[model samples]
Target: MATVLLLRHGRTTANADGTLAGRLPVPLDDVGHDQARAVGERLRRLPLAGVVSSPLRRCRQTLRRALPGAAVTVERRLTECGYGDWEGRSLSELATDPLWQDVQRRPSAVSFPAGEAMAAMAARAVAAIRDWDARITAQHGPGALWLACSHGDVIKAVLADALGLHLDGFQRIVVDPASVSAIRFTPQRPFLLALNDTGGDLRALAPPPGAADSADAPVGGGSGAR
Candidate 1:
């Protein structure tokens, strides 16, 4: 197993406009670039085994600034959930729709008209992350760390899965633009190391010597990350 950093793409033009960008090719706004660079500064302290990204433009732009010269694997499964008829619509306006209630309270059952289902989005995202985690561990050893830049809802779904929460409760998890959530996968289960972290020291995420292969939790929360 390996550690995976889940990064939501920086804010975009649609975000500032309160619109749902969905799978549209929206690029990051000016503030987003600054956020990306700041996260990059923090991430530079760790040695990332690999970097993967959603195929969407905003995600790609975020990674381009965050990792600079790092090679990025474009994963379609990490792309934004298709909002279908809701695409490019203002969130304030969508809130008035009858379907919006379902989206807010029971996302597991939400299937955007002419778009992808919420359950389906969660399935693919968790699968992609688990698969990539396995690959990174195998290629670079259990201590390896990697990153995946994706959309907000998609990342929230993945985090919900990691937290062992039902999709209906996903809205409770807020994934702000450019924030980072971390998870470490093990044979027994996945451990959520961080959630919706906007600004925090990430160096502690690197495994300590001789500890990478252990999946057991520290007894009594033995010595916090060094």
Candidate 2:
């Protein structure tokens, strides 16, 4: 089995103001940095096979601080939704828009006013995970752990797909910033091991120190989404 840890980037000024950051270059706020450090400390105990992150500054910073010396690959497929025209807008401001209701109640049919489609986001994200799962499984073998640090909606979409839930139902899934979720892929089936696991203490899922560790191995890197 190959396990992927979906780690959402920490808080930012937009997040604090209930704004939609979209693919902006928003940096993490003080609390977000603190959260990243805490999550990092908890994750450092595990011997991760790889650390992947979105190219966004906020996510990149979070991964760098959390994993410290671990080499991180930027996967654009794991980017935050392209909120397009809504970038930097307040959540409260969008609440009255009829599209907002559709977003929360019928996400599967949503095509942002000028942004990415919900289904498209899920498709690419899921595809990316499948590819990474196979690559990591082959390199580290079964029961190995890898990290995919990305945005909240992105992680929720991954969670929804793994749990066999409807895309619209993804709205019900809460993925807080700096949270950790796990989805392990096995030959027999896919497993949803964790969701929004922010308390850390993930030692139980670790494959033991030096157990299939790939710290010295280099993984590919590239530009990523916010």
Candidate 3:
């Protein structure tokens, strides 16, 4: 299996304004562009086999600044969770709704009014990532690395799945804008290599030569980072 880097799109006007821009075509703010550029610099340290993005404007803009002319595949399944009636509403306002508590505490059981269910979002996202990882491994080899730029909630759900946590506990995972998390899939299970990493050396993520693709975890975490 290949390593996949999950990148949350940069901050947007809705983000700064405390609005839920769910499924809306919101653009990134000025700060978002700077953040994207910075992350792009860090990403240049590793050789990414490919980049996939949500079919949203903010994500596309972020990638434009992050990877420049890099070809990006737009995946509809990676799009922001459908907020339905809650789209473009302020978060503070939504907090007063009865469903808000469930969203924070028991997301697995809560579905947005006229929108998609949280569990459904998690299912589609995990499936998309797994499929992409398999495809990348087949085309680029097991040691290959790739990236997916998506929304905050979608990334959180994916991370929760990778960490073997129930969807209800996903609220505990915080995916800030422009942050990057990493996961490596093997025959046995997925390993979370990084989480909500805003700044760190990413070159260590590259597998060393002759490394086995489906190597199992060492009893004591093996040698740290080769």
lDDT of each: 0.91, 0.84, 0.92
Model 3, residue pairs in steric clash: none
Q: Which ten residues in a row have the lowest lDDT in candidate 1?
A: 206-215
Mind giving the per-residue lDDT tens digits that candidate 2 earns over 88-205?
8899999988889999999889888789998999999998888998999889887688999999888999899888899989998999989999877655556676789889578766
- Worst-scoring 10-residue span by lDDT in model 3: 206-215
> With candidate 3 superimposed using the best TM-score fit, by how many Å does residue 175's alpha carbon deviate from the native?
0.6
Please, what is the TM-score per model? 0.97, 0.90, 0.97
> Model 1, which residues run further than 4 Å from truth?
none
Where in model 3 is the C-alpha error above 4 Å? Answer: 210-212
Q: List candidate 2 stretches off by more than 4 Å.
A: 207-226
TM-score of 1: 0.97
Worst 10 residues of 2 by lDDT: 217-226
After superposition on all CA atoms, how large is the RMSD of candidate 1? 1.0
Supply the global lDDT for candidate 2.
0.84
